[model samples]
Each structure stands twice: as structure tokens, then as C-alpha cells.
Target chain A: MLPNLVVAQAHDSVMWDYTRKMFLGDALYQFDDRIRVSLPEFAEDSMQVPVSVDASAIDESIVKMITWADYNPIQHIFTYHPEPGMLPQVSITFKVQQSTPVRAAVLTESGQWLVGSGYVSAAGGGCTLPSESRMNDDWQSSLGQIRAGRFSSTDQPGADRYKFRIMHPMDSGLVANIPSFYLEQVELRSANGDLQVRLELSPAVSENPSISFDLLSSDQNYQLWVRDNDGNEFQRAL
Target chain B: MAMNSNEHFEGVAMVFKHLRYALMGLVFCGSWVQANPLDYALTPKEIAPNTWVVTGLTEDFTTQNGGNIVNTAFIVTQEGVLVLDTGPSKRYGEALRQVISEVTEQPIARVYNSHHHPDHFLGNQAFADVDIYALATTIDLIKSRGEAYTENMYRMVGDWMRGTDVLLPNQIQTSGQEIIGGHSLRFMAFSGHSGAQADLVILDETTGVLFAFDLVFYDRALTTPDTPGLMQWLEDIEALSLLDFKTLVPGHGEVTSSTKPLEQMREYLKWLDQVLTDSAAQGLVATEVMRVGIPERFSSVALAAQELQRTVSHLYPNYEDAFFAESF
Candidate 1:
């Protein structure tokens, strides 16, 4: 166990320990540099902070990927299972309750969990506050509206980026009398209707949740399907 | 029983003696403390013939300062006093009125809010009777985010924000020239700092004094949570510099006669834009971009590092989006 490397790179917190146990279930894990977790140092707008996980550098085939914020009221962010066509890369926006370590854990085919972590400093008040959607009178009309597109990656020729945003409140249920209403499941499919990646989202995701994924470029268009906890389903073609 | 009664009387006498001392202390030090704690100590400085600016501390909001980190000015003319930008809170606004009263006998005829930021207009409660004027977009922004900003202020500065409520500007200020109290004022609307059609810059053609609110931070680091874009801000700065003004009053820093403020704004804004764009192109993470070293030139500017970190958090994601993928 590279203790120095772990101490230098990973700023361990008590919440991270608890989150690790709850998510990984005492599995064998290592703080791996190959799996990179990136987030802003300060959450300027705590309700929506852009973060990403890139485990594409790891040579091993990833079996499962999970991400969580250490100090959020709801620690879980998302869990992703990438099929053959998708890369082990995911970008998302989430709410940060406070300054805490955000981690992305990727389980490989070798049965070892590789964790990447980053810290975000915030003024907090992200979870407890009511969302803008709650105040808008016509929020229902805009709810679950999906806007998505597939663009060719400028840097990488053979890769295409799938980006989508779904109108949602993503309420964490921490505010008074506001129940948890958020996107629960997201599916990305190739042109042939083959499952490329499936994402399980939580209330920890930001309002108007936006996500991105990079995959091998193909001739046909892609499709996105999302469902919220309230059973509202939205579909978009890119 | 006789001895116990005598001892009780002696104890009562001692208590009275201590109470007398406490009363004396309260008469002297307690009055000063009570009167001084909430007082803004606003002193109007005459920057021009009839233009007085009540400058605030160039610092972040604190319980000690009570969110007095903005400059509010007033121009006394033949007709009356035309106020530009109220202070942070009701207490500050009342104090400002008191300061204005001390300088001249003119009543506050009108009020102009430069933008919808809490510091610029939360004190509208003090001038609630006056016909407060602001841009239409600014009025809309205040209507939407003013309550949240008020709540945030109460959390930041505590009791200083007492009785501070959002008061919408009753009149709309458009892009044109207007003569108020013998002062020929030119109102130009700029969308770079806050949002599109929010920031209103005024030029006093009479005194050649330009009130460049929030658009020019002078020696302070600018806040950009609501800024439309850096390029737009740079364009606004260029447009403001072209105005024929002898004295420049920035929204945050000290009043200046030189063009140093405009130069500094251009330099800082271009550096910020360049740093963000290059860092995004290089795929630097937000944390790494925030940690990038500040230029030596900006060392004298207050809150440069802190505001840079905040700017990165607010704007870097957009820059990253330009380089990476697109989100609708």
C-alpha cells in the first residue's frame, strides 16, 4: 500500500470513510491516480457545480463506477455501468452541501476498486434551499424536458460526445415540506438501439441536471431516455 | 437572631454599593459601545464642487463592517439632491441620509440604483419615499433575486441588515440624457457586468464626473457571478473610457482623477479572460485554474486571490464547455 501517495493525493475525511463503507461494502480498494475526479475548488453556485470522472486512462475494463460527495446530506451522486460502446468517462453537475471530498470509485474486472477523489470548497446551503423550479408557476410544463446533442470530439477524431440536459428540480427533500423529486434513471443507446451506458441518478444531482459522455463515433444517431422518481419519462434523439 | 439580621443588612448595603459602580460604568462606556457598534460612521467626501461620495471599506462582508463595502454618492444641485446608488442596509441608508443632510439643505429629489446587487440597493428602505429609478432589467432582477440576497445579507452581516427589505425601483431609467437639478446626466446601459440591460453607468456632464458603478472596480477585484461575459465587460470598459469625464468614481474603490481605473480594469479583465481560455484549452481542472498564480501587478488589489477563485468557479465551467461538449 503506497501510504505516502495516498496521504499526498487523497485528503481523507471521516465522511469519506463512512461513504466508502456504505457504497463499496468493505471491498478491496486503492486510491488510483488513473481514475481522475475533477471538480471546482470553490462552489460559486453551490446548487450547480460541474464535475467529471475520467477513468479512461486505466487499462482495465471497468465493471462498475460510483460517485459520491462526502459531506452532502445525500452522499450518493450517481452510479454508472458502461457497456461495450461507451468509455469510462462521465461528466455531470451536482449540488455541494459544503466543502467536502468528492470521490469516484471504479471497480475493474480484476475485482479491485480504484478510487479518485477531489475536494470542493463551498459556502453551503445547496441542499436545504428550495429550488427555482418550486417557485416557478409553470414548472410542470417544463418538467422532464430533454435537450440533447451528439457532437464530434474536436480533439479526438474517432470519438463523439453525447451531452444532454433535462429540466428538473432535483429536490433533495431536505427543505421543509419538499419531497425528493429527481431523475432516477438515464439510458444512452446507440443507433441500433443497443445499450451503451445506464446511469442511476440521485437527489444529489443539480437542478436542470446536465450530463455528458464520450463514445466511439458511429454513422447513426444516438438516443437518450430518462425517468424521474415521479414516473415522468423523457426521451430525446441526438 | 439579632446578629443574623445585622449581617443581612450589611450584605444589602454591599450589594447597593456594587450596583452604584455598575450604573456609573454603564453611564460612560456602555453608551459609547451601544451607540458606536451599529453606527456606519459615514463621512461624505467632496470629490467635486457639489458631489460628495461616502466611501466604504474595501473588504468583504463581515459582522464588524456590516456589509459596508460599496461607495454611494450624491450630487447636490440647484433643484435638489440626486442620489446615485444607496448603501448596503437600511441602517447605512439612514446614516447616509443623515450625512447628506449635514452637507447641504437640499432634499433627496431622486434616487438611481446602478444595478440589482444587494449592496447597491438593499438600502432602498431608507429612501422608500423617493422615486427610485433603475433599468428595467435591473428592476426585474431585483424583483426576482432581491429577497434571496436580503436573506444572504442577514446571514453575512447579522443585525445590520435589520428592517432591510426589497423595494423595487418605481421608475425606469433608459439610455439617454436627462437634466436633474442643473446636472446634465447621461445614462448609458451596459450589459457586461451584471446581465443584459442591468448595469447603468451615469456621466455627469455638468461636473465631468462619471459614476461608473460596479463596472469599474478600480483597485478591487470585481465580482462576476452575474457577468454576461468577459469580452462584453471589456467592451463596456472601452466604451466607458471614451466618455469625457474629469473625475471617475468607481463602484468599489476610491474616487480618482486619473484614467488608472479604466486601464486597470482592461488589464485585469483581459488577464482573467486569457487565463480562463488558456486553462480551459489545456484541460486544466477548475481547482488547478483557480490556483494559478496572480500577476504581480494585481498584488495591490484587494481580494484579488479570493475573487479569482470565485471567478474561476463561476466562469471556468462555461469555458470548459466551449472546449469540451455542448449543453443546451
Candidate 2:
């Protein structure tokens, strides 16, 4: 699993020092080779950049996983607690304000931080831009629409890729009158009712959240369940 | 122990050989080619009498070629010329203006933006003095999302967008026929392709030329980043086929007179819709759906494989969501 990691970040040494101290809170962190961060080298759309964190090698011993952007004004992106029977791997789409270090810190059952980091260069202003859906009058009626699909991985053999998006305002509370509202939790499950992955999100993600990840299986049947902070639950099967 | 003189020379020769091979690899791979300002050398071919179009290359946006992948046209009448949708950047627009000047001495009087897509309207800055027209919804969308599109284009094409800026069209194009330069032009606004009240198809009554801007793609695969659905786009094509036009200028690809391009577009879109909807109903995830084989009928369409992948990424999730709701 470590050999498949793509190390495109040029400032790995410097980013590790700053992000480790900022996120780990002086706790001892081992640069776990099994942890991998996958993101595009250059963000095509700063508003909706896709990122995935794969820690399947150490899934059983993981407790909590925290992901953040070191250069964002709202640095804390999300934190996930992989439920029992769930894989430690998860994918999410979020906003990035420029070229910044994105770090994922995995806390193990033994209380050690396993750190993985990558860099994504953005065109800036994803965090502050107003939602494009706001321009339409029927935005409210269209909220909570969910879409999901899957494809076989071309690069990673035996692994299938999955992508889904939910229509929501994902308001960051920075804009006047629009309070903080976003999907709080998402869970993916197999046809046999086994948890595959879990995600925790915040307002830092772009509107109409698009999430994508790879499952190391050829199985086609799966279900995606999501809930917002407002108690709006949505589910889709594919 | 220090190396002998002969041994040192041998080690240096090996290092030089490795360096030479590395340099050769870079050249052979052509991975070092950076973004450069493209000389479009735009030439307008008259598809109809007094109406000319500058065809753009049917290719994806790349740093090496910039994002000049759009069709722009102009109609010269007794009055000044009326320009159609502009190209991708300010430079492209400036070059287009030069080409138009060489064709006729008439000043460009009015500019019509087919939709709010950056490739259709980002060149508005070059026609600042002229009255640019677009749908009201398009004007609003550009005001809201123009900056984000501009930033994304800059990252995709790099320095080619150096002088480009987001310039919104001021005039509103109501749904009706209007006389411009003694030629009766009919305009209909629809929303299917770009989803945000986009796709404006213009028809010239005198010359029987239809400027179906992003609404039609000759041989190129359609873009779906903002598409509402395949059904709506099919309806749009049906409406376009009803028009009495001898020549058709699509948003991308070469100009043509036959209805074969429209037929191809309809067949491809129908197939895509069926494949995605059926896959979702069968409870297949995006990965599995993407692996579904492309029919040989669409094998000849440019970027069919790649565009199919993108379409799955964009639309399959919605189908899955609908399927889930129905099951529940």
C-alpha cells in the first residue's frame, strides 16, 4: 500500500513539521508508510477539488482520523470516526484557498499519530465565494438531491472507483443571514450490510458536495447514506 | 583509499552518460513543452453569402494550445457587422476582430453571447464599446460565477489568459425575431446543455444560416458540466432540426450543411442516457457503470470514451439517487 503512494508535494519535510505540531498537539507522530493522501497536483476547480485518504492497511487499529488544510482560514475541514466494520479509507470534496499543505492525521488505538500529507495548488477564493445555486430561485427545492455512480479503476487493479454528490447549500456562516448548514455524516455500506467507509464534513466543503473514493473490490452493489446537521437524512443505492 | 586516475575518468564518463540519457528521455517524452501563446491564424470561411465563421479546433483545453476551442462568427449587412459568440480569451477576441476587419471595413455594431460559458463570453472585454447581448439569466450567472470560471481557466491554460477578464453582456435578448442590419434574425433561448438558462440558437432568415452555438456539436462529444438532463438536450435538438437553415455553424467542430451532425448527436445522447439510467437501476456503482462497454456506433465520435467517463461522473449519481428514492 505504501508503494502506491504518489508523493508530488515538494515541501514534504517543511509541511510535516508545521502540520504535525499544529494538529497533533505535541503528541508523538510516526510517518506511517501505510497512510496515503491522494489529491490532484493542481486543483481544476478550486470550488470542488476531490481528495481521498486511504489507510486501509491499518484499518483495524485506527480510532479517529482528522483532515485539514494548513493554509485555510478555517483550517479544520472534518474529523471521522470509522464505525465498527468500516474501512479507514474515505473520500471527500472541499474548498482550498491557494497552494496549501493538506494533512491527514490518523490516531491509532495505541494513541500514536500516523501522519500523511500532500499539497494542492488552487486558484484561490473557493472558501469565500458565494454558492452558485443561490442565483436560482428554486435552490431550496433542489437541495438534498443525491447522485451516485461507480467505475472500474484504470490505474489501481482490482479496485473499483465510486463517486457521489449531494445538493446542499453547505453554508459556511461567513455570509450574512445564511447560517452554518452542511452534511455532518456520511456512511457507505455494502449489499451485505457491512460498512465500507464513513465521512464527517463541515461548511468548509463546497456546495453540492462531490465525494469519490476507491473500494478494493469488484462488487457493484452498495448504498450511500448521509445526514445533515439539520437532521435531513438522504440515502442512495448503486 | 583514493581512486586511481583511470578509474576516476571512468566514473565521470558514466555520470555524463546517465545525464545524456536523462536529457534524451525528456526530449523524447515531450513532457517539457510549456504553455505558449497560440497563433490561431484565424481565417473566416464563408458558409453562406455575406456570413462567415471562424472554426476552432475540436480539442480539449490544454496549456500548450490555450483554451481556444470555440466557434465564432459574424454577419455583414448593409449596416455594420453583427458578431456572434466570442472565443475563449481576450487575445482570441482581438485576433478575431483583426480577421473580421480584413474581411470587411464595417465596424462591429452589436455582439451576441450565446450563453454565459467563459468560452462564449470571456472575450466581451475586446468588444467593450459595442452593445453585447445575452439572456437575463445568463447575465446573472456570469455575474455570480464569472470569477470562479476565470480562475479555473487561468490554471488550465496558464499565460494564454494573461489579459483576459470577465466582461458581462449588458443587453438582454428577449425570445423573438429581431431585424439587425436589414436581415431578420430569430432567437430562441433554452436551458439543457449548460443548465443555467443557457443555449441560445440564432437563425438568419435571409441567408438561411443557423448559428446554433453550444447547442450543437458536429463530431465532438458534448460537455455536461452544467447539463440539466439528456431529455432536455434532445428536445433542444428537435427544435433546432425544425429550423429552415441551409448551413449550420455548431459551437465546436467543422461547419456543415447536412443534418447528419444532428442525427449523430441525437443517437449518441440517447445511448448515453440509456446506459447510465439502466446501470443505476441495476444497482451498479459509478466504477462499475464506467466500465460498461461503449457501443461501436459511437466509436468514431471524437473523445467518445473520455466524454462518456465524464458523463458518468456527472450524471450517474443523480440517477442513483433517484433509484434509491424509488426503492425506498
Candidate 3:
């Protein structure tokens, strides 16, 4: 680690925050530094904050990665971890509610932790979905197509990529409380019982679930299944 | 005065007809005042002394299942006007031109495409009279991707762009600098979305308005995964903020004097980069990352949910695999 990286733990402003110093064993979050990466001097009022972290310093394998703000109602953005022989670098795109400090912490191998913090500003709550309507939107993958039946893969690579547009309203549930609820899970598998991947999701994902991954040339048929936090399940295949 | 009952009846009939005409006129005026959403011009606001950006009904490309036609732009210059990007149809491009003519009649000296996407380049036929410009990479994509896209457009607006020669850029942008209309402009190559994309930064040798193109999506969705480098795209946006321009014209949205969106784009990139990196350690599959969305800090951007999902899908697959192969 460079000793010269200055820490701004003492300063504070309404539009930005570059006052926090990163300590050893703390979560390393992006755009939280005094001189943030790819930002407008870390001071200008802005919306989305691009964040990244490097966790190679730890000895144990990382099991999960999560991010949250001290003030946000939704504390977990995404949980990702390498299966094995995988490197650890967690990056995400996020918004700043206002001139607020942001944090990123890694759940390390030794059951220990590290986190980094920075600041950004928000003009208004995002204009996409209203905080109240956030609940009513469908954000979980619709296994509706899976039930329609399975089909064979096309011969060409780009020409015949089987496409699945999952429906979910990933309401992070942090916006003003709405009358609706959130989606929970999505699953995909091969029709021949060869291909499958299970995903346990949260509101941290986007609304109207959209999930796509490649099926190797050999995989003949495929299936997709979904479930909400309420244990509801949906399945589709191609 | 009518001397007979028949004459009186005819006079009344004439009065009724006149009143009906008056009522119809009033209704017409009221309806005209309520203009259709499509009726509004893609108003080209003069952002700089010689530059302008047109903001219209910015539709999400994916949401339309890829049917949005126009949200265009222009780069005005005293020497001549260089239209940056064109809309979907000739009519859309011409509508853009009609609004453009409201300012100067300088020949549309050159049309420089920032990338190869159809929304930004399909209306090439409308500007057929001028030399078109694009990156060498963009030219290659248009040849391959554009051919397929054009065939698709043939089904949609073929009659409008019939016999229109789809010309490649006679001039390819190679460096960060170019001289246009006697003023210097910077063309930076950013390839996170397309294989070879260009973001044209127009700075006034006098005024500092920048036609940022798609590099900055203020108040709109960030980006869709047309390619594999969301992180690099974020880097490009951050790099733009270091520049001196005070005003910016995004590819699909309104012109803004604020530098805040650039910063916002940066933060969003940083967040995505970190999330992907963290996932890499666990060997998370690309689909797994898709289930996990972006943070609340980004929850507010207009199309954040859809874009966040797409960005994750494109970047994480390569990212997770890369880390497994080399360890990020």
C-alpha cells in the first residue's frame, strides 16, 4: 500500500465528502478517496457513483461481498464471491442520495473484514419508479417460459442465443414504503439435466429481472425456474 | 328585413351555420394548443456560440424492445455545422434538420458519428449530402452490424431511406485533436459499449460547451451492454470531468451546465467495478452477478434498474472468467 495516499477523515461539505481515511483491514470502496477514480474532483454534485474494490490482500478466500450506506434503508446491494481459484475484485454502479459518504466492505477469508468510504451527491430521488410504486413492479425472473416447454439450441453462436427476459420488480424496499412487496429468487437448468445455475436474489437487483448467460455448444436443451423470497418458484426451458 | 316566413327561416339557418363554424374554430384552437408529444421539435439549444444539443423524448432502447428512433444532436461552427449524431428515420433526421435550419443555413459540413449504434447513426441517409465521419472501428461495426440493422430498418422505415447510400466515414478520427470550423475539438476514443467508440468533446477555443455524446447520460439511464467494458466506459466519463468545459451535451438527453452528472457517472462505475471485483473472488457466475443489483445510491437514475442489470450481465461474465484465468 502506498503510504503517501492522503486520508481525508477530517473534512466535510454538503455537496461532497473526501474527509475519510482508509485504514488497513477496512473495506475498500471506490470514489471514496480524496482523489476518486474517474470522478469530477470528488466534489461536484453528481448522481451515479461508480465503485470498485481490490481484496487480494487477504489470505482466506472471500465468501461474499456486500455494500451499503450508513443511512440507506437497503443495506445490501449484491452478494458475490469466487467459487474457487477466483480472484476478488468487486465493482458496482450506485447512486448517491445526496452529498453522503459511501462504504464498501468485504467479508474476508479469516472471518475478518475491511471497508472503504467516500462521498457523493444526489439531485433528487431517481426519476424512474416512484418510491411507492417500487413495490408493485415485477423484478423476479418469470419461469413462465420454462413451463411452456424446452427447445433445442440453435446452431449459430450470435444468431441463436436463447434469450430469457425475467420479470421482477427488485424493489430494494428502501424507498418510501409502498403497498407492494419484493421478488426473491431465479433458477436456470438444462432440459437434459446437464445445465443449471441457482441464484438467491434480493431487492438489490434491478426491477423486471433480466438474466442471460451462455449455454455451451454441447448443451442441447435448457430450463429456467424462479422463486420469490416467499418461496414461490418459476421455471422455463429452451 | 324578410318579408315572408320562408325568408325568416332562411335567415335563421344562415345564423346557425355561422355559429357552428365559430364553435368548430374554437375547438380547433384548443386542440392545437394541446400539441401531440411527437409534435414538439427536437429543440436544438445553442449550447455554445457555435455548438448545440437537441433533447427530445429520450426512450430507453431496450424498453422499446429496440424501437426508439430519434433523440439527435448537432455541433455548430462558424466555418460550417458538423452534425454529431442522426436520429432513426429520414423524417426524424429531417425534423432535426428543420430545427437546425432555424439557426444557420451553413451546409451540414460533416456528420461525425460517436459510435456505431443505430439511434446515433441510422439517419445517415438524411445527411447524405455531406461527408460522414466515424472511427475506423465504428466503420467496421457499421459494415457488419449496420448491414443487419439496416435490413431490419428496411422492414420499419425502408420507404423513407430508400436508395440512400450508407456511406462510411471518409474521415476517420485517429487522435484526441481535430480542427473544425476554425476551432479545435477533442475526439476521445472510448470503447466500453462498442468495439471502437468515439466521444466528441467540443470545447470553445472561446466557450467551453462540450457535446459529450453518449459518454455522459445525465438524468437518463447510464448505458446498455452493447459490448463488454462498462468499467472502461466509466473511466472515460471520469476522464471527461478533468477537462475544462463548463457545459455538456449528452448523446440522448438535455444540455446541462452542471458537472455533477460526470461525477455521478464516475461513482456508478466505481461501484460496479468494486461489485464485480468482489464477486470475482467467489468465482461467481455471470448470471449470479445479475441477480445482485446496484446500490441505492444509483437506485434513482431514470433507467437504473434495466441498465444496471444489463451492465452486470455483460461485464461480469468476462470479468469473473478473467479473474479465474488471471486473478484481478
RMSD of each: 7.1, 8.4, 20.7
Best by DockQ: 1
Instruction: Indicate the worst ten consecutive residues by lDDT in candidate 1 chain A.
Output: A147-156
> By DockQ, is 2 or 3 better?
2
Candidate 1: which stretches are off by over 4 Å?
A: A1-20, A26-38, A52-65, A80-91, A97-199, A208-238, B1-36, B274-297, B312-328
Output the worst ten-in-a-row residue range by lDDT, candidate 3 chain A.
Answer: A36-45
lDDT of 2 by residue, A1-238 (tens): 3233433342454455565576687886666657777666656556766667778777556888999888876667778776554456666778887778788889988888877776787667777766777656466887778766566655567766666678898877666666778888888888898887777887888788767656676654788898989999988786
Candidate by candidate, in order, the iRMS in Å equals 5.6, 6.7, 16.1
**DockQ for all models, in order?**
0.14, 0.09, 0.02
**Which candidate, 1 or 2, would have the higher lDDT against the true structure?**
1
Global lDDT for candidate 2?
A: 0.79
Q: Can you write out model 2's per-residue Cα lDDT over B213-311, one digit (the tens) per residue?
A: 888887888988788999999988998898899988999988998898899889988998899888866555444565578788766678766676567
Q: lDDT per residue, candidate 3, A25-143, as tens digits?
A: 33344332322212112311122334444455556666654444433334344444434433454443443444455554555566644454554444324313443223443323232
Per-residue CA lDDT of model 3 for B95-143, tens digit only, reads 7778788888887888887787766777677787788888887888777
Using TM-score as the yardstick, the better of models 1 and 3 is 1
Interface RMSD of 1: 5.6
Tens-place lDDT digits, model 1, residues A199-224 = 99989899987688878757766778
Q: What C-alpha lDDT, on a 0 to 100 scale, does residue A69 get in candidate 2?
A: 87
